[model samples]
Target: MDPICTLAVVGAGTAGCVLAARLSEDPNTKVLLIEAGDRMSYFTKIPLTPTVAQQGPYDWSVRTTPQKYSSFGLWNQSQIIPRGKGLGGSGQINFMMHGVGLPKDYERWESLGFKGWSFKDLRPYFVKAFGTASAECDPEMCSADGRCPYSSIRFENKKAASIYILKNHRELDNIFVNKEIVLAAGSVKTPQILMLSGVGPEKLLKKLKIKVIARNEQVGKNLHDHMNTPVYVSIERPISITLSKIFKFNTLWDYVWNRKGLLSFPPMAGVEYFGNSALMLFAMGSASERLMRDLSNYKHEVFRKTFPFHHSSSKEGFIFLATCTQPRSRGTVSLSDISTNTPPLVNPNYLQNGRDVKCIVKALKRIIKIVSSKPFRDIGAKIHWPRPERCQSFWNGSRTSKKIPKPAKTLNKDLVKRTTVAENDKKDRVKMNTGNNFVSDDYLECVVREVAVTGHHAGGTCAGGTVVDHKLRLKSVTGVRIMDASVMPSPTSLYPNSVLVSMAEKAAEIIKHDPAIHHDTLQKTTDRRGGGRKCVKHVRQNGLQADQVYIAQAQVSENKTKDANRCGINSAFYRKKFAEVNTIKTTQQCH
Candidate 1:
């Protein structure tokens, strides 16, 4: 007999592992956890080299369908959306920047019919899952004893400057939070799981031959992401170098001798910033106290060391100005085929919204201004990709290209020349259609069209309430549920891992007491109750068998006399008499 398990959790990434571990706490419940990839313990736990987590056994490198809005056209290059297949999910590969979403973000969910999912309500779960070691503590916002690990990177230099930048920018000081799954599997895998589990558009599922459990047309729709265009500056000296080279020969010896140096830091140490005014306000004030506390508790010891000050670069250093905010552009995730193992079709319509262009442009300007401050006058920073001098030209070209009008064409000259001009004019009707028009606008339109990219934050496939009902249950199905970031009604400006964790935590709680928990067992018991009805059928069959046996015995007795007379004298006459007698006897018995 197959072993029976009370709960079967798939995908041992952040949410999966956490759910399994937490649910298994009850000794009575047996949990069967399945992961498509290998374990990610070593890769996830170590703080030194998180970037390595993107490759090897832990990563699930998924590709997207070619985007229509992009300049590459139908045959454009595909986008690669990576999610960790191993344990801890994308959290193992993430930059480890802990931040909580704005409170208004959650309130928006409440408005959308996702009851009990408001930021205010979900705060405790986030606090319960993580422990913080950062010096700052907002008890209401954070917790000290949580199962999930939380810490900040320590810096070696310019602590004051780092603090100044964070303090001056209220937006950067916003706290991040997490609770259950950590949902760090990134954008690609989250929606892929939802589509595979039969919770997406009906047309896409039918095309893939997947039976539709729920007909949510909006499952993979409305995917939006933040795209970062790197502006590099050629530094005269390398300000930040890895410990791998500095301690090459004696690296192992140093680590063994003392647990110190560059080996302790995470990859790509950086601070979060919001250039968009609306986002800045939302991050600072719109969020709840609990979320703020959870984020404030994260101690970035590594970030503090790497980005210590506004002028914390080498004698000549580069600054990575990222546009952390995004526009509300949407896309989709649909099934490629019916096979569960096959990946889904992902289409993240990045930069489809015009506002996103404006946001990115604003972010670029902010980065230029910050680096060109009076304190950095002597450092002499230069914008590498789009030089400061070309800002005007770039902006102008972008604007002009967006507004170019369609060209107008008159009827062919051949028709006009063949007939009298007046007669031709009277016969022919002018057609006004903007079907084929080449943009002759400024340079920015062409450039904007050429440089668009994705931020890799696709979401809202199994969106809460809108697609799936509030209990995380599929709106049309009884036994299914969606626990990934696809359940998010909308993508948050901050990272989604923490939010996903909290959502999973809530899901796990609900599952523990769900009616479906005993549904199978109850069904089996009911089947046994109906088993008695089969006995009546067996009795009827037995009666029919007995009647057939009696008829066969009577026929044998009747034939015995005819057989004996056949061997004696007058065999033909005897046989004929016997047949006649039998027929007469049969007719008399029937009467």
Candidate 2:
């Protein structure tokens, strides 16, 4: 028989590993971590086999709705949204080009009403996760005070982790929760689980004939991913680690014997090419004060402002890559079927916003400059950009043999009615019969619409002030809280695995200490500060059964004012803002 536990954390990925390990430290709370797949394997240990690892049983193999503005991918499929199925999640299959966001981004969150999410609040978690950056990266490659202080990607799977893995729950069954269920299943599936459990937008739920437990309209809105556009480059000599090298036996011996080969390094690891989003856009498209002013209004702006570039690291010459580090376009994650057995309809809606299109256009221009730079010139590197009329040939390959990106599929009639923006854009868009340049706006926009893909970082589904509160609790629900990329008001500054680990660290801290014995210790902090206390009564949710006796009181001191602020306790600002629930709930009216 399975032993019951205090906390049931779903998804034994990066976030679940951290949460389960940290939460289990308190012997009083038994953690039941559930995953749809098996534990860590040998392939995850090998940093070089990212592509191979993603193809096997460990991958979720999700694809978006055929993209309207971007190529779906080869073999008549939408672009793949790669999600890891086993332990370690995407961390197991990710390229391991680890990174974090700018500190100022958190500060911006504070200004935007996320009080406890400032850099000062989240810095300790970042330090706990990845340690710190040691020194500034190369000046030419970096645009800021770049510091990659430390490297801690050595895999250690056997550190008091999980012992059991339950792939799925039975149909029409109830999960008995002692305290709460923590949803850290990640951005893609967390919302799916919630909607399946009947907590999501009422319309979406109603459409699928699923019973609605809560009316959280923003359950899967605000989905964002880094927009990536790759330009293949040709170098005169063998400088980068490429596919040609992988075909050779000598390269294998170099990796196995000396650990000094292409396999050991992630794509464009130490070397960098960073450019500011605002500056590059201005440099490329000339000045538009409206566009520059519009930059600050975006949460994507709070992300890494500079676009980071890398190489395909191929022998014939590597591919020069450009990514819109922060994209303004937003998408949604919706239910395809009522069953959890089906994957959610994930639509990152890549390049829905005109601003994101403009951003990537600038990014493509930047890639051209990098190839043109003297350093690249010395290495005989030139951009091998493949457009509709272009293809790579060792000895003047024929255009007919080239892989042409097939035209995007026709818009779904239902999707067409809902997506007025696309129809309008399509109507106004003039077909370019002629006009192709290595660095032209129209040329690049065509490439982006045809070949641009996601950086595989989808986040900001259950964002703050939307589906969940600042504490990541599902609005109008109790005994549940979210802990994943979906809760992030926006995507992280860089690759989000480390940041997800840190967030789990912080979330585990919250779960363990909430209404626990530590209140006595926290009480003293208030005493030391000579702060007054208030017993703040907040309904876990208002619309409950008339006989429902769900009452939770939060005893907050001035030291913990942020908690009170979030719950609408003594803060007059919040009280006035939420005047509907100012005094107290009348049981008769509430029910």
Candidate 3:
């Protein structure tokens, strides 16, 4: 028989690996980690080849439902949301830019009634996850500092969580967790996993003919992501990254043998924060027509006219990628069927909110301001704005009379309904005194509606306060927890990779000390082959007839706290009683 573990973690992504490593520190407690994707391979190991890795077998390459407001430039108006499928998961395929996010980001979560999730509460976890290493010491590495000084990412140790588990804890391989099952399958898929396991919206489960273990209305509700629009700038110098420079024999040799040089470097050169959002600056590198076509999906005519020198092998330009980090718009993940094989319908609903569009436009103006400075002027940098026909009239030097386009009609129908005609007219009244070099706000808004794409930082589907409690446990279910990005109340102001790692570290600590997990009710022998079905069958066959007794005891305990306020009584007390009584009843039933 396979050995029973104290905990079972699903999805061997960054968070799952972290849990497996941290929890397995107890020599007596075993851990079982299950992954749906293929194991790690050499293809995903390189630092600079994230796009290449994304194209490989390990990436889910899931496409979102056609956006009603945005992604007009993308193929079929459906943005591709790439998710890493293998052991290391997205950590292996991401740009390697680690961001812990601003303090306000977590403060917002605390404001939402997530008591222990403030930045102050989560700081230690960040320190614990990143170790003593300094990413800033390495020229190639990039990471956020100031508040999270210890947080760092290394090119060589990119797969730190996965590597730690595979190398350090080989003995805990043959095991299955009897106590608890934790889902860390990322934001996009974790909810699907929960729904498939019969813990989801009751109506949906009934419709699909699946058993309802628990009715969680918020399982797949709060889906949101940072959307970015890349603004390319043409430069006189060949200082930017190019295909010719990247494919050089020496460059490959240096990365493969010495583990240094351009090939080992991260794609994003730098990041600049603007309030809660950010502008990620990186070289366009391979400006070839084919590569540009694949990356942006803008019309061929627009690309040809805007980036005329893109056909050349030289460093054509750099991209000022502006992202709206804290978008108000929310979307969802839902199932059309019961099978886990079927992809969950992901609708990010990018730029659905007017605020998100305005935020991106503000960042674009900032990019223009920066490029106008002496430093950029010295490099002869010029913005290559994509002239989609709709936005062409509002261009800086358009031959036609420049009039501020009616944004209300151009935007989403819902957004249009919310904004009165007076409000739109008021916004249009802002002086079109934008210099001959600058375009009007109307043009930028249209550009945002056309060109924005997913920043690949999707989260908040499961969400803390709704699907799971502050402790990361599923509120409706017992012995199950979610410790991935799905538990985040909102998508952070920056890259969520570092924040997710910190969350995993904190979750490990919570699981280690939580008294509820140690109860006798969870110690029953689990069926290895049948998965959750056997456990559910075991519970049904044994039954929780002692629930009435526990309820009586809970009532008695609650009465002791004047007027028997439900909040006054510790929920843990009821859990302990339920566990003890159920254990006894199960034993009696067996006899």
Model 3 lDDT per residue over 389-413, tens place: 7677666555345453455333467
Q: Locate the minimum summed-lDDT window of 10 residues in model 1.
A: 544-553
lDDT of each: 0.43, 0.51, 0.63
lDDT of 3 at 421: 69
Q: Which candidate is the best by lDDT?
A: 3
Q: Model 1, stretches more than 4 Å misplaced?
A: 1-3, 41-48, 69-75, 132-199, 234-238, 242-247, 250-257, 275-316, 378-380, 386-453, 513-591
Angstrom error at residue 140, model 2: 47
On lDDT, the stronger of 1 and 2 is 2
Candidate 1 lDDT at 162 equals 9
Clash pairs detected, candidate 2: 101-493, 133-148, 133-149, 134-148, 134-149, 241-313, 242-313, 242-314, 242-315
Cα lDDT tens digits, model 1, 1-591, are: 112244544444546544554454444444433334443445344344454555455566566676555423112435555566644556556545445578877887787677888887788877754542212112222111101111111112211000000111111111111111122233455455445545567778778665555577776675665554334433333344433243475655564466455444443455446644221111010112222112212123312222233232223344353554646667776656544345667777766776665565555445444555664455454434331222234332232333423222244667656767445433421221111212122222333334334444556765777766888765654434556666777767756766666666667677766654523331111113332011112111101011100000001122322222110001111111111110001100000
Ranking by TM-score: 3, 2, 1
TM-scores for the candidates: 0.60, 0.66, 0.75
The candidate scoring highest on TM-score is 3
- After superposition, candidate 2 runs with Cα above 4 Å error: 1-3, 72-77, 111-113, 132-175, 247-250, 270-314, 389-438, 516-591
**Steric collisions counted per model:** 25, 9, 2
